[model samples]
Target: MAAHEMIADDLLAPAASADPHRVLATLREQDPVHWSATHRAWLVTRYDDVAAALGNKALSSDRVRPLLEARKSHDASASDRIRELLSEWMVVTDPPAHTRLRRLAGRAFKQQQISAMGERIERLVDSLLDEFVAGGHTDLIAHVAYPLPATVIAEMLGAPAGDRDRFRHWSDELALVAFGTGGQARPDRHERALRGLEELFDYLRSLVELRRTQPGDDMLSAMMVDDSSGEMLTEDELVGMCALLLFAGHETTTNSIANGVLALLEHPEQLALLRREPETITTAVEELLRFDGPIKVLNRWVVEDFDLRGRSIRSGERVYLVIAAANRDPARFAEPDRPDLSRNPNPHIAFGRGIHACIGAQLARLETRIALAEVVERLPGLRLDDGRPEWKASLASRSLTELTVAHDAAR
Candidate 1:
């Protein structure tokens, strides 16, 4: 790849080995808004540029429409179920629809409601830790990180406890189809994703029906009745909302916990600082998120012609906001690469910005704070068993395939 060539072309290559930060920093300095021939979208890298683009009105978040349209050309029938599932996702819709969905779901994620789960979360954390603490070695992802949030979200959604593992499997397959790296043209992967979605929808529909006949004190039951304004989610909307919450609820937090722990292990000083002053765990969680958050890239489609970084971006074009790169921009963060537990005034868009920001942000933070606190406190002399941890081959979210660690057997 030549120096002047668009970086997206190389980034999309399966074997591209250049560090992502170096490539993004090069682009941020030379061409912050260069159009990519490979992705057919503009790549936004700088912190300010990415943040601004996230809130730009001209950029739309209605990603499902394009996929549905493309799939209509071949196998239109298959697209129906997928569309029904994705169209109701709050993250992929524009205003009015987005506003309504956010309003309905946002009520359940209020800080007070999330805080109430603290005791429940702590008990869950303790139960999970008990399973692996004695073994002295375990895959944190499977034993703790994945199950903690999966179980929490499952209980909140009133899903059967026995089905948590199956739900996780479906979530994994859908993630590949919905947010996998490379382009959106893989037939085999999409077929698997559609099948997963079908099965998930079937299960959720039954759960919703059960809640209708035999209402329980769960979020699903709470969302069934109308609000004071007499607005209630339709059957399709309810199912879609449940599906989105079930998958997104655990996926990002699972990665966040894994990534946060890895970041601390890599920087022993930061970990030591966190150990000495446990009160800093709150700020430490923020720093961990800033240092190595789960999400890597976010997509927004241009709704109208606009000037960005002195370049004209045409309508119908897509833009990839490299959030991971932006978080490490030196201009915005001093020593952007270093993990400082008490770094004050740290403003990172890890959960995103604007109207479409993650609604479950508070819940995720609470879970991470509790999980990290317990792990660091209970498990002494913890260290990575594998020298080289594996990262998932994904562009949507930065995740570990597995994270095995060992600690003192006495603990």
Candidate 2:
């Protein structure tokens, strides 16, 4: 299909999911600000455009709140709860509110706290790998990628270890809606997503109450208590934030680990370099993030008229800042398509950019760094299984459905 003929679903196609860099590169070069008739959104592809759009004040991140007013009718009220919770998310709000929420939430991700988690994360990786390597062949995602970050975030939130499985289930359900499944209507998926949202909210509300009564040093407790400015998060806000944290915390990291491993395994030279000089894991992780990161497209609504790359973007229109495309933009990085473990000064916005940049980025970086090091150290002979890897049909994020691999058992 012609680049200009690109529709919203084009990005969600299985082929696109498997190799988005190729598809995005075409759009980036041909039409940086291509309009999608089906999605009713402008897809900003180039590195410059995406970087600019992320920090652009003309765009508003309050996409959820707009839906709240538009879908005010009785028929739409059924999903009002979903929209209400989403609107409360710090990610979907503009200044003042976003500023306040981010400030309060930012406390949960202090540098010291993240730094301290290294040993604990190391222990978790070792423990998980113990059980993981027992099987000669296994799905890396299910064994390591999915559980590592999930358990870490769960423990931080004071969630019971037994409830980790439930979190994964709920997260999967939420992904269907959160990532915009192929831009196709699926009532079943929407219902499951709503159920997952409601269930998560209810579960978090109980946790919030418990933290309020018998607070601890956990993140949820930290969020509930007053900050240096004596600002306290409201109960609903706390619940919403916790839900967002749990989902965002594990989901992206899970994808990063899986994608990072897949990238390394594909590029044996890079993998060998990581094995030879383990210190380079940090840069390796950054390169892995840029090569195939979790974030794909971040949504924004144009609240004011703006001209971008010779295209006019009017108010009340949706804009999709294609991070995947931008990260691979040849104009920004030398050899943008290749994966180089030692690539320095990598400014790829895998976690996003500007005020809405990922709050959990440091923690994610820590988790990924530890997780990749352990995998490379332990699974020395690891290699992909015979069949092709499956990529989730998602537009908002890049994720693997599964990554089955086998390693030499003589370790």
Candidate 3:
């Protein structure tokens, strides 16, 4: 690779965040285990390498511990509350702790329970669509994508419908830290996230207490029970679980719907095919996830020395697994750039792989399936506005800041 290509390969650069596919493609071909000076981490861009790294036991997922340890001399005291809460998040843990949390949280998202919510999800989608269609044009992310899953997850936790906006605000603030967004390292963003987490945790703690006294037929209530293992989550653990579910449950699903819609609008032929053959919605959702999935990158800390593609990674080093790039690797998918809604046997890792795979994968699929079907069928002449859509500059997920589309509302 040339000197300029290396200079342009900064993952944290504004241009790269808007659309990393180009840079990722170059790295995938030239240097599969490229070390990014800007990020000070190893970039794993190949399909096989990223896949193996995700399942690699040597690469630990406890990101919080390392982050706090590095900042211990500076402001670990300031971040104490948030760090404690974040360490409890299942996505940030490894091994026995993650295993226990997964076992307990798994009860809330059983296949039967998720399937039973189909009718309710459909109703929610229709209701949201009805309100947005009143206007000739609207931001799809705000009207549909964000609300559908936000409402579903909130309702599942038995949270009062009225408090949706509050938690949504909290989630948004906390996401600045959870997802690797621009300026995330700044003290203000960290402070805002800390405040948001504090408030949200307090709210969830109270909700858990209520459920403890009078259990209801909801996820929160279900989580409070002791299963075959006879292990129930402690009060703090339950609060942390609720916070993680409420945040993760909606953030990824929101981007999935928005990104899927933009991809379809960009590829008219594929959109028309889906409209003509609605039965392919299931397959379409899978393809959409592959073509332009929401999650872009995931990071892991090396706990033991490992070698890949002739590159040696030492212990305590950071590795970034580029999911978006891996999904489009030519070795894995044919015509990787194009969107083919009917593509089958598509084994995309949009929801990730391994034991830490998204716990709410089924629910996200169900919501996106229903939302896409309704949007395509109801909104005739649905097309992008003249203004170019804005993409969020984040390494954690590929998401739109907003997606405005015009449609034939009269129809």
lDDT of 1 by residue, 217-314 (tens): 78888888787688888988888888888767777899889999888888888889989999999999999998888888898889989998688998
Deviation in angstroms for 24 in model 2?
1.3
C-alpha RMSD in Å of predicted model 3 compared with the true structure? 1.9
Encode model 3's per-residue lDDT on 235-344: one tens digit a residue: 88889988888778777899889999999999999999998999999999999998888888898999999899888999999999999999999999999999888888
Ranking by lDDT: 3, 2, 1
Rank by TM-score, descending? Answer: 3, 2, 1
**What is the clash count of model 3?**
0
Q: Per-prediction TM-score, please? A: 0.92, 0.93, 0.95
Best-performing candidate as measured by TM-score:
3
Give one clash count per candidate, in the order shown: 0, 0, 0
How does model 2 fare in lDDT?
Answer: 0.83
Q: Show the colliding residue pairs in model 2.
A: none
* Model 1 deviation from the true structure expressed as Cα RMSD, one decimal place: 2.6
Q: Report residue 309 deviation for candidate 1 (angstroms).
A: 1.0
